[model samples]
Target: MVRCYKCGRKMKYIRGLKFNQYAVDGWKCGDCGEVYYDADQAQRILLLNKLKKQKFRLKLNQVRSNLILRIPKEVGEAMGLRNGSEIEFSLKDDDKIIIST
Candidate 1:
């Protein structure tokens, strides 16, 4: 639990698209509107930001009835992606594909 340092009010939990790349969990102060992150959440966001800066070249392949996009071992490990893990993909207006875990 987090407390508002300025006004002594309880903080509320919230998540959203922040920093133009990832959605993070944080606390918002009810009385003073201050925002803060817990220790684990802060660490996760930092690693995610670093992973977002990495680029990988992959060859698309067909397997059975699906198209497979393979991620590099280092890149996947850095992003905490494992076999059979689920991911989200989005196509931006500029035709760039965004992948997130």
Candidate 2:
């Protein structure tokens, strides 16, 4: 069963494809419009997901098990995070985050 990469919904398998560089499959998400460029990536992710569903996965659910952040006190003050205020944590790309706290 094919699932949308972004939306966790069952997707209709339109076709298997071999693009200029990779093997892929076309799937349309009912809730979102994110098209996967490489189906191999999706399949790999789905395998892990299936393992989790089966209660057989035992992996850290993070990019890093122990992440570290060291910002100067002045910098934290400048960002108005010195008073225990909440801050937003946003993804910088696909692999990093910018926590403004």
Candidate 3:
């Protein structure tokens, strides 16, 4: 049971995206609309923010029947992604795209 610092209301437990990647348990105050994460979740959010701030330029290559988007070595290593790791692609809008593992 957590309390909202701003509105002094009881916080409700909710599951939300931790870093736009993983799901995490957090608290949200109904009255003030404030959100709070636990220690581990907060750390994950910080790491994710840092990762998101990093910029990587990649090139696309032509495969036999399809186009392949090359993932940089540094980015793959930092994200702990392997060569055969499974990933998901999402198109948010006309131009924006998101990829996750």
- Those runs of model 2 whose alpha carbons end farther than 4 Å from true positions after fitting are 1-68
State TM-scores per candidate.
Answer: 0.50, 0.27, 0.49
Worst 10 residues of 2 by lDDT: 54-63
Clashing pairs in 2: none
For candidate 3, write residues 23-91 as lDDT tens digits. Answer: 778898988889887767766556666767888777889889898998876567656689789899999
State the lDDT of candidate 1 residue by residue for 1-101, as single tens digits.
Answer: 77888888889988762533566677888778788765565676676677668766789999999989988876776567888899999998796898878
For residue 100, give model 1's deviation from the true position in Å: 7.2
Q: In lDDT terms, how accurate is model 2?
A: 0.56
Task: Tell me how far the alpha carbon of residue 93 in candidate 2 is from the true structure, in angstroms, after superposition.
Answer: 1.5
Write the number of the candidate with greater TM-score, choosing between 1 and 2.
1
Cα deviation of 92 in candidate 3 (Å)? 0.8
Please, what is the whole-model Cα lDDT of each candidate in the order they appear?
0.76, 0.56, 0.79
**What is the TM-score of candidate 2?**
0.27
| Candidate 3 residue pairs that clash | none
